[model samples]
Target: MVAPMSVWPWGNLGAFKYLLFGPFLAQVLYSRMGEDTAKSSWCLHLLIIWGLRLFIHLLLGSFGNMLFLNQTRRIIKQGVDFKQIDREWDWDNFLILQAFVAFMAYYIFPSLADLPLWNTRGLITVLVLHIGASEPLYYWVHRCFHGKYLFTNYHSLHHESAVPQPVTAGHATFLEHLILTAIAGIPILGSNWLGHGSLSLVCGYLVVFDVLRCLGHCNVEFIPYRIFERLPFLRYLIYTPTYHSLHHTDLDTNFCLFMPLFDAVGNTLNSKSWQLQKELNSGCGNYRRDIPDFVFLAHVVDLSSSMHAPFVFRSLASLPYATRLFLLPFLPIPFVVMLAMWAWAKTFVISFYNLRGRLHQTWAVPRFGFQYFLPFAAAGINKQIEEAILDADKLGVKVISLAALNKNEALNGGGTMFVNKHPDLKVCVVHGNTLTAAVILDDVPKDVTEVFLTGATSKLGRAIALYLCRRRVRVLMLTLSTERFEKIKKEAPADCQNYLVQVTKYQAARTCKTWIVGKWITPREQSWAPPGTHFHQFVVPPILSFRRDCTYGDLAAMRLPHDVQGLGSCEYTMDRGVVHACHAGGVVHLLEGWTHHEVGAIDVDRIDLVWNAALKHGFKSVSAPRTTSSSKSNFIS
Candidate 1:
């Protein structure tokens, strides 16, 4: 069998007083039954007044309780943590006792005796004094409660509800509540004795103050700071929902009732509270500081010292108006010095070595001078390299190639080959992949003259062309196939195409020659030849011969007579545009005249030697046609 819990009738007596007597007294007072009463009659009149106030407060409290209960039910149904709704009414009796004692001491005692301190003038003085004195007293005593000695004994009960509910406002040890109430009453007693005021005034002040205190500690957000803080006078002195809510949550600072000035002046304000408020208002997650050290200091400081002494002292003697006026003229000197230092540092102090390292490691080196033999490949290779070379070339424009050349060997045996072979041809190569294009382009030097494309159409090539075109870069296409060449030309926007054409024309005029290589002929297929022995030639100056078996090296090896110097010069000039010509014995022929006459022949070996020499001279290798293995086998056979 389970044991039965003992019942205490007194436990429910306070609740009974609230429910039964509250409404009856409210009706009597609201009807103004004791407005013209003497001091002797005032006690009975106040009983009616307090009863009415309590009645209305309980009515609201009941409604609030119903709302909270409904919310709790909903929360439970939604599977919210039950501990969030944890409630304990253990301190209700103590709070009731405190309220009873305050009512007797402040409202009831003098009513019975018409004491000089109980008059209207005395009450007014007490109300005014209470406003000024109660706050500082509460602040110091509250600070003491938080001290090491009192916290564990008296203050811990209040802190038991870390997330305080409305009922938890006055929940504390009986002695603790009595001590605080007595401290709060000191101002009223002292002020009444100093300048006696009215009972109505005193009662009104207590009623309003208690209401505010209770509402401030209420769990429900009735008085939103957003609305209340906007009021002019209320914004200054009265505490808002936020102010008191922070006191409960923070358990420090905001100890004063009427204003925050005391906290600010005392330097005991919880800096974290201000930071939290800022973060909450700004919707920023940037609160860095946690606990404020001053809160602990506030706890140790003696209450007498804190309450009696002014928190902040103002003294004009520290720095007179004359001193300020004297210093005003020199302000510009510091400003001028700072400005000059900033300008100098910005212009000359910063080091380029770090930038150079970043460029070398992360950014692709700009290809400035062209080398025909080496090719570079990487992400955004075409665009980055082209931009870099163009930015680097000032005197003459340089073009970039879509070729793979290792960074380590690029200067000696890579993209530099094109510049070395054709000293007059300015070009460079930038290496990158799709991921690196943006970085490479961003860091590309400003001297590159042009960007050139080789091989098939690729994203990198298109990106490079697009980037250069956007930056008003001179972009040139040097591929072997008319299919891709025409596609690129057509795909390019009208403005970009026009720009590219203008750049090409300008480059051609400057070099005095332009070569259109590979499959980009007027009638595309006209250049395509069948496999096997066939004559390949071009029409040029009369100095060179169009032969099926002639090479450039054979022409050089011929050591033509001195009288034929004009023919050699003509041949050299024609070779600039003549990209390739195949001969019957694997030779390259230099065709001459308007009809491409066979005037001279060069063997394959001689052609190879000349190409090798050009390679040695730094001429990048042009992409050759990939012949089928069957065709090569048949040629060998």
Candidate 2:
């Protein structure tokens, strides 16, 4: 619980808090545009300081979240939650607000503003003042904040996050940050008052401060213990992540800022800090992390959406992904990384979470959605996916599900090639389309006697057509190939065969009020559907809602079990706690511990079986709001 005094003045401004620098930015732009380019340098300096503060957090935060990193030695075993993320959403507001103060300081003290770019004396002065005055000041002030009255009113908010991450370093109350600002400013301002200040000195001090702060809270012990082994006294000179984690767990010890020497002097240092650091550093190499029981083999949707990975941005990954204006500047970084992945051509872990004590992970095939469409990229993509499956088999993974384009029919025959070639494999390969088909079919009204279906020759389309035909519903399957249509019709019972009718044009559905679209359609094609027609879709990149009068169903999806934990990232465009039907299918497979592989053609007989299994395991269908009619079809416009 946050005390009333701990609340910030901005009161959870979120991303909009960056606008606090707008007035300073406008002045910088105006000065740069006019004759006084010299005055713009200080403004630019302040902006760079602000930017570096944010960049350091992102760099360390993303690095710590990478599963390939030394995760075995992670301080906290649990994942971050929405509450902690929301609390730290405005973590950088302090830097922006302080920069505004610095901007005013430039005008008040012309000597401080017109300093040289570099000065050896200024650097020396800052290092001396930081060690001699600033460090001691911060250590004592920090200990004072832990006192009962101060802790309850101001310090408890920072301590709310027991499982710390990079941003947790800045997650403090306004009054606490005001004191921190003074601690950080003393060395630089003291240097300026002594006539040795320089722009490089301020920049260097701020960068080093952020680096140390992020390192202590990053949760992952990145620094090697070999250095301290070589020089034992250096342990007091520098503190590791393990050192700081003990402080959060045991609030009475290890309260120094960046150095353990101060804590030692104050008699508040934890005795086990060095011993635990050695244990963690050795464990990183001596032991392996826990293997996941389930893996979701996924692919990148697009260039822009690639940055929505958990490692990249925690806040952005928590919500349904969209193209944001603020994210445009960061595109070049992912572009370079994308080219490297394309060249490497391997499957890598993206993120993971736990459900009912079983570990579930998501791994990517290092290819984008467009690359899957390219004729030349199919073989390489399949090879990577096949290797991942084989690796999981060796590692004793119970179930591995192919998601999105990984299960594309033309690419690898819905993962049939791998399963067939490795017939003796232990791992259960799942296409997860059975549950996907069930979710779509469940939306069809029981009273409806006829429906128009597009892309009827596709995998999912064929199953829906056959299932409905068994119930005596007339299925107008639109396809150019009569031969393919007959193949699916022949699979149905002899009595139900006549219920499947072949139609090649949208004009044939002019009077149809129920349309199931498995393929993309334009406004002109959609015009064929009669008014009040509910368009049930299984299409990728779902069709546009050109007609407001017509209702459209969302792609098949299901809500995850309530027992799910550490689910910090959204699955593509799904909302929090919801997953695509294919993803839910994988979860159901794991929970049921089914032994057989779920690959190749979806079994129409097992559609109800899988749907019932999903419900039995507490997964619910993701349905939109509906207006009831006499027909009883549930859909929204």
Candidate 3:
């Protein structure tokens, strides 16, 4: 029963495939020992196989200097600009030992003595079975390697190469290498147990498998896009070069080898594949390099009492309506008068390091007291914002976020005026209000049906109110003016989704389960609420808080966990465990791909993105939840 020429279908494609496979002697074993007995020692035979693999791999690395075999060699030379080509040799030092272990652990006997009766049907069946079985099995195994323990000790060594080369494909701990080799044998073992074994086909399959593995990791793409662009469906059948490269960069995505079927099934496909592939092909890593690595924006506030003017503004803002009106002439200069006093605060360049010890810096610009209370500040603030953009441009900021009054002034336009004004400049200005709203909403309890909100006329308050109404949640809009209160009530119905929204003005001596400190509420105004209720605080200059406080405060998304305290060391302090929401928005823009992405106004869709990113990075309230404890941190009654 002589196996026909088609029995070793891949064997005859000799010259180049044999050079690439390197185990030429194995090919000879198949040819000469068709029906012969094994006389030579099996140990020497196995050693020769491993030695040939290493030799062939080194041959490819060396020949990369001499000639081009596919586009892979040329790509390795230009793609990542890897300075140390010799580094692979360092990783290669372990190969012979790994190969010996692999042989001893699995391929011990003279399996070559019984080359199966190979047929075309068995070849196709086994190839398909190997691919199908390996996809899920390897997907699971690969995910397991990402576990914190295994990744730190074993699998992480391979991930050191952000830009992988061919040699890196085999670079792994002995355990990982063993696991890979063992899984490759599963299909063959199953076929043998089913009485349909074919060792000859297994040999060809291994050769193809190795070639594809190296090709994927080679850092060069030879697969013509025309094949997929024209046929489209063909992409699902085979993994592309970019597919594996994405897996190396993003840990949770692109988990499958050989085919992406399991990756798609598990919903782990890299969402940025197209954008990243284009960049990779252009010799850029997965992220943008066009802009400065870090950028931060700030809105300046006028100071009267300490840098935190909340104390000063509270006294003037909280006087009884008649008393405040009689004293209107003495009220802190109107925004117009203050606008004349505006000057760009000294721009501070902060140099710092992250938890990972990566050095980063930010440029902060202060706007002089432009919050809404200043009245005519909006129009004046726009011009100052222009000046801030110009200053930020001099330092080459890639992304900038508007804070506080600046965000409020630009809420509707969302810095579009600034963006449109500086069309020629290379700076991206964002309102960042979307993320502000997101973190605030994250602190609210999911089951709550009624929410008491202040600052009913302001953008932050309105955004929160509308958001609640759309979800059929009732909100009590605490307004000071009867005129403004009625206006809001009139517009509430049309603004809500299918649900009819309920909104009401706050009166004296009221109590509620949940209160949202939505506006730039003074410390005195905050006391008006029942001290027994739960509070979601969004004010930048938070009211002072102490242990065993009367009311509990919910703070969300603190960048510097060390900043949390019962009494803030800076100008103002938050209730213990409370964080500022706007801080997370700034960080999200910096770490996310530098797309010059500006989150303007309230895009519910973009808000979800920042919210997910904040949670993924563990940026949440780090203090104890509320209870009816009493303390003297900064009680104001």
Candidate 4:
């Protein structure tokens, strides 16, 4: 490089000072010489240009970058894992090449005397046309470098820093450094080729350009996703730190430098980038903006889940501060009551997938499944119903179907009690007795002539008795009193009065071959049925503690046999493959896109409608009609 000095007579001593220390000398001389000196003489302009470059890139750029990095460390204390930091540190030697790249760019363009001062047109060319023309050229070069031969031998070295630092922008080999220099020159040199560019414009562009380059590798997310949400058109104009991070993590994607236009044109943008943006948005300030919709869509305990299911944690946080304040006056009274209820109850939501269809559903617990437990004995029955409904709604459950005891005891006018108590709730509630009975009746063995229908005194029991009566099966109905029994008999379908047998004693139903348990029965020694008897339980969580000895489980409980292929983790709470028809009826309503509960009397047509829905949605019988277990699992036995 010093060979030039040997040729010129006075160059030897001058070359030593000017070539080596030109930028430093320029900085000092320009500071003292003033602007008039720079404008008057090209010699002074020459030194000042080098001086400005050194001042901006070496001094301001480095110091501002350090401050930004330090502030970022303060903002996020739980930084990357130790092993990742160590892995990145091992590649620190690569960043030293950056100065070499910068040195090449500084001297390679032209002598100061050859370059013109910045004109307005040249500045415009550098700002817009340079980026526009360079982007496509750089995109292709990047794609070529990603190819197998080039990637293995050269480009892969730059990818060593998965989470990059500011200095990592220039962490490339000598060949890559040349490639980087070329891509960077496209705007400056390409514009100069078109005859509108100046060295002043190129130098000025580099100063601003390096800021974005360093910021891109800073491993910081400085852009808000909502900015793109509001002004999506600008997404083409900006490249976030997250954008460049994607380039590192997903090596073949997002190859464009400053904008996404070519990447979109090439169709190589990482699909996960948008998803990651939404996840990042959730933690960002936009959470407050989404509160109204979340509050509107959320439920306490939803049996049906939708695609727009609200975030469960968001819903929990959305619980009004007023709710806590309302308990304040009552203080220890309401507080102690809640504490008592907590001791006595457990709450959970169970999800089921593939539904044999496009949708999935969840079952929230603390429900009145059966009478065996003290909670189901109506101790906290109202609270349980409220808890389930509230949580399901909070989970973004669109609708809830009150099944078994949830219908009769909690709300007297079907679901009206719940509606009145929770007027603010948007989750639709249904008694679902009509379709439930229809589904249950479909489970009754065709050969069976008699069914011991418990809870005959209630609306659910009466509905099932009618379905059985339609089938001409003898129904030995149990009622709480003779008065309720006579009322049901008179209200019952008159065509089969002789097939209906009213009994006050449950023991009398023992002679019946089949049982319809719409209500929970206590698990006393006398309550257990004989060996040949089969049971269809409408109740959930069975009154019995899941014993194999309990004569027949809910035959009405249907499951999707093919559902196992896509069930995923939602199968954790399922028994064999069967889901309770009552709990499942809500899912049926959801799949059918119905928002109301066809309950109270009985919707026989709805029964047929949902039966077809069950078949259409891929629900299959979990076991043989009278089989002791299902092939779904050994646990069923």
TM-score of each: 0.33, 0.92, 0.40, 0.44
Show where candidate 1 strays beyond 4 Å.
1-46, 49-95, 98-124, 220-236, 272-637
The candidates, ranked best first by lDDT, are 2, 4, 3, 1
User: Which model scores highest in TM-score?
Assistant: 2
Give a tens-digit lDDT track for model 2, residues 1-637: 8565577776656445657778768768998889766667788778888888788888888887776565677877677765677667667666766887688778878677688888899888998999898899999999999999999888988999857888888888888888898889889999999989888888899889998998899888777889998999999899999999999999999998888999999899999898788878777543347689999998898888998887888778777766667679979988898899999857888778789999898888898888899999888888899999999999899999999789989898888999899999999999899999999888888899999999898889999999999999999999999899989999999999999999999999999988989989999999989999999988776678788889988778899988888777778767777888998898899899899999889899999999999999999988662222121011100
RMSD of 4: 21.2
Residue-level error in angstroms, candidate 3, position 56? 68
lDDT of 4 by residue, 1-637 (tens): 3221112222224213234435435544674566634323443443454455433333322332232123232112122222332333222222223323444444554442355766567777666764667678778888998999778776776786444655456555556655565666666765666667665676677666766776666655556778888898777777877777788878879998777878889999877665565554455433221111111111222112111111111111111111223223544443453445346745433232343333344433333223314444554555666776687677566667764445655444565666777777766676656556766777787888988888676666777776677778889887768777776667656787678788767788766758777666776622545556667766543444333444555435566445432232212123434555555666666667776645466655466777778777776554343332211100000
What is the Å distance of residue 394 in model 2 from its true position? 1.9
Model 1's lDDT to the true fold?
A: 0.36
lDDT of 2 at 258: 84
The window of 10 residues in a row where model 2 has the poorest summed lDDT is 628-637
Clashes of each: 66, 0, 4, 19
The alpha-carbon deviation from the true structure for residue 214 of candidate 2, after best TM-score superposition, in angstroms, is 1.3
What TM-score does candidate 1 reach?
Answer: 0.33
lDDT of 1 by residue, 243-281 (tens): 666776677677766566567656766555333443444
* Candidate 3 lDDT over residue span 597-633, tens digit each: 4634455546678777766665664344533332221
